[model samples]
Target: MPAFDPCYTLIVLAGGQGSRMGGCDKGMLTLGQQTFAELLVHRLRCSAAAFNPGYGPVLISANRNQQDYGRIGAQVCADLRPDFQGPLAGLEAALSRASPDLPAVIVPCDMPLLPDNLPAGLLRSVMADQRSVAVLHDGHRRQHLCLALWPQSALFSIRQRLDENQRSVAGWLAGQLVADVTFSEESVGALPFACNINRTSDLAQLPG
Candidate 1:
């Protein structure tokens, strides 16, 4: 087995309008008292500290709300694409900022209930296989485009796809040697991290 490398980057995509939540900023919505984005950053930071201590870095891709997210200590960046294309745009922007040699684990801002051991699992899988990309699968279907481990070699292809206006993450991964780390639903349960608060009704279901 290949020894795990502890020098990977974590990038969180947080630039969405949250139109499904009645035009609210999904990241700013409060789950308990703290905003969703704040809680996510805290969880990610904790997860990184515990699993990949002294790793590359943790960055957040913010849109017009860069200042608002900057207060949370994440290296804030703006999408270079003309419009808010989607999470892929954010990932591309993050790739440009990160060290090309270091791998990156990307997560979405709305998945507050992300499994605690995600980083470790992803690292293990990536090290075992020299694949350029991998993501999490829950047996049924893929999770949001939230979880992805990308290598530097992918930057060129990603940028080329963007230039061709192909913003679908699934399509991008289909062209790569992608691996899926499967998780049992029983182990994860119906947590908010996996459950995205897209609509008002979804937010209402959050644990009080």
Candidate 2:
């Protein structure tokens, strides 16, 4: 596989209300030796370095604890609409701040075991299919927020969707040319690719 360009932006979606996790900031939750945000940013840095020199800094979409998230050395941004307009709002916020011409790989901070191949695999699929988006469909379902790549051009459509009060990420993607990349258990080895920690119990299930 050809090395992916190092210019792609990494948008970490951490702006959720965390209702399922008892109103806690899932991104700030500790997993093993690092916080969810720290671990993700670190893993992505190493993963990107393997294919190229390095990737861009982590642009975290955070509604609260902006100062804490920023302390992790990531550029923290928040949704323009208040009271948690959902992931779409976070996506818009991060995309607007990203380089307008480059594509961005979006992931949720709660999914600590996101595949190392996510960014490169999605990029390749989108390029090969000439689509505007690429996202992981983990066998049974579309893990839209778990992992997805979006071209900067989609920013306009997203903004329009928000204006129309459509907050569903799936609804937004339904209108786009999406390349659905599948990551089977066999393909990901022991790693539970796209698995997320939505509750405190889910955290106990994390791989050691």
Top-scoring candidate (TM-score): 2
| Whole-model lDDT, model 1 | 0.72
What would the per-residue lDDT of candidate 1 be over residues 110-182, giving only the tens digit for each residue? 7767765676666666666656466778677777465546547678888989999999988888888777877
lDDT of 2 by residue, 1-208 (tens): 7667445677889999899978999999986778888878777643554455435656899998999999887789999888899999999999888876556778899888876667776677655553468878888788888544554567889999999999999999899887788876632333466777887777877766
TM-score of each: 0.86, 0.88
**Residue pairs in candidate 2 whose N, alpha carbon or C atoms collide under 3 angstroms:** none
Q: Candidate 2: where are CA atoms >4 Å away?
A: 1-6, 46-55, 128-131, 147-151, 186-191
Candidate 1 wrongly placed segments (more than 4 Å): 1-5, 46-55, 186-193
**Predicted structure 1: clash tally:** 1
Candidate 1, position 198, lDDT? 74
- The TM-score of candidate 1 is 0.86
Deviation (Å) of 69 in candidate 1: 0.9
Itemize residue pairs with steric clashes in candidate 1. 113-193
Candidate that would win on lDDT: 2
Alpha carbon deviation, residue 9, candidate 1 (Å): 1.4
